[model samples]
Target: MFPKPIEKSSRSTQLTYQALLPVALLLWLAPLIAVALFAIRPSVDFTVGNYWGMPSSFEFFENFAQVFNSSMPRYILNSFMITIPTVIGAVALSAMAGFALGVYKFKANLLLFFMFIAGNFVPFQILMVPVRDLTLDMGLYNTKTGLILFHVAFQTGFCTLFMRNFIKALPFELIEAARVEGIREWQIFWYVVLPLMKPALAALSVLIFTFIWNDYFWAIVLTQGENAQPVTAGITSFNAQFRAMYHLMSAGSLVAALPPVAMFFLMQKHFIAGLTLGAVK
Candidate 1:
């Protein structure tokens, strides 16, 4: 059974919830607050192990400027290059594949759908060595294309699961109507199904963009340097040989996090609708 809404709670329960809300909120935001404070602190504070303490001097602008002045901009661009292509490639392929699995009737359809779902359950760590060697053999190691391809492939299974369910929830009568009116299957999908899938597509795009952008493990495993490394891994560029630039790394981290945050906010409406499409009725 679900917990009742706060509005339905007794007066004492309401008071207790209200009293604890701010504390819970602060606890959730504690790490983010620490990171922000770290970004504004001068380098000396970190050198002297003054973490969790107030900054001796605020150097917010200077720290962020240093990050931009370094190869951070290149890494940001690389993130966009890799993230955008992967999102597009994964979503597009999944759309077609989902249509087939969700719309058509075939003996192997359920098996293929299960296979895609199974891929999601496989531990990614197991594929690390083989995936790296595969890129090397294909002459794509340390290349953005390689990273993009790998992300697309890895993401497709989850995306297919998302899209196929969304497609299945759509009224099958629409497809029948289109067929009766003499529209080709491709035309029906492109004009009818794709248009109706905007909410789902927007939702999936934001999700995939966030996942690919925040990926540091694959970034380090599959690519190297500013040419191919995304901002997530490139944040390590702040580390020097003798010491770590914690302040600069903090600034870089905040900068790297902005795009995905902005993406979610901008597409918030469609994302919510897409997710809740079949939850009701």
Candidate 2:
């Protein structure tokens, strides 16, 4: 509707548009395609100056095996260690906060909501030093819990904004009915509103999964070494260890990027629904 339907365009314009679609897709996916192809290529291919040629040998399994046997698995485990707890903590906290903002009429409700909305857009670096110091003070520095806690707090800001708007858009009569029935506040939130938030939850879960998975800066600032480093940080180490080993590096990159990509594909319906929840209004 925004651009007008293609059938409304001239025939020559339609032909040009159709022809450009594949080219645009290829351009967009070129980096990912190269990485996937390189992941299956033999290590020697880099040394032989055949970066773009057909693989002399497909060593996908071998490379995958090597990565698994190395610190990659540990990196993955650390990634999960940070990602899952953050997802639960952020989503849970935001659900409560969002419900409060959406349903209540406190003096500072709008102000607090705007604070969250604003905080969500701030650069992570701005909070890096204080967050790191707080982690150190709590004796959680360089630990998975520290990273998880920070992620949970920081991510809650955005999730609360998203969920608040989403919850606000729902019918209020249901809430009024629940209140008339003498439902306690918390029970109303838990029973009446939470069930209707499945789409928002799914979308936020996938989105937060991708955010935490691809996180690198906080991983570096909060944790120092392999003891707590996630895969995104670990990939930098892998790059250093495997100089000129593009095949292995590409493989590691793909592996590191897989979970979030898989999550996007699987939860795409809910993701789109949540994103577009308030766009129409």
Q: Residue-wise lDDT of candidate 2 within 23-110, one digit each (tens)?
A: 9999999988989999999888988899898899989999888777778888989999899999999999999999999999899999
How big is the positional error of residue 269 in model 1, measured in Å on the Cα after superposition?
4.4
For model 1, what is the alpha-carbon lDDT of residue 97? 93
Q: Give the winner by lDDT.
A: 2
After aligning candidate 1 to the native by TM-score, how far in Å is the CA of 23 from where it should be?
Answer: 1.9
Model 1 — which ten-residue stretch has the worst lDDT?
Answer: 272-281
Model 2 poorest 10 in a row by lDDT: 272-281
User: In model 1, which runs have C-alpha deviations exceeding 4 angstroms?
Assistant: 1-16, 47-54, 269-281
Q: Which candidate has the top score in TM-score?
A: 2
| TM value for model 1 | 0.89
Q: How many backbone clashes does candidate 2 have?
A: 0
Tens-place lDDT per residue, model 1, 18-111, is 9999999999999987888889999999889998777899999999888888888898999999999999999999999999998989999999
lDDT of 2 at 104: 91
In model 2, which residue pairs have backbone atoms overlapping below 3 Å? Answer: none
The residue-level lDDT of candidate 2 at 254 comes to 85
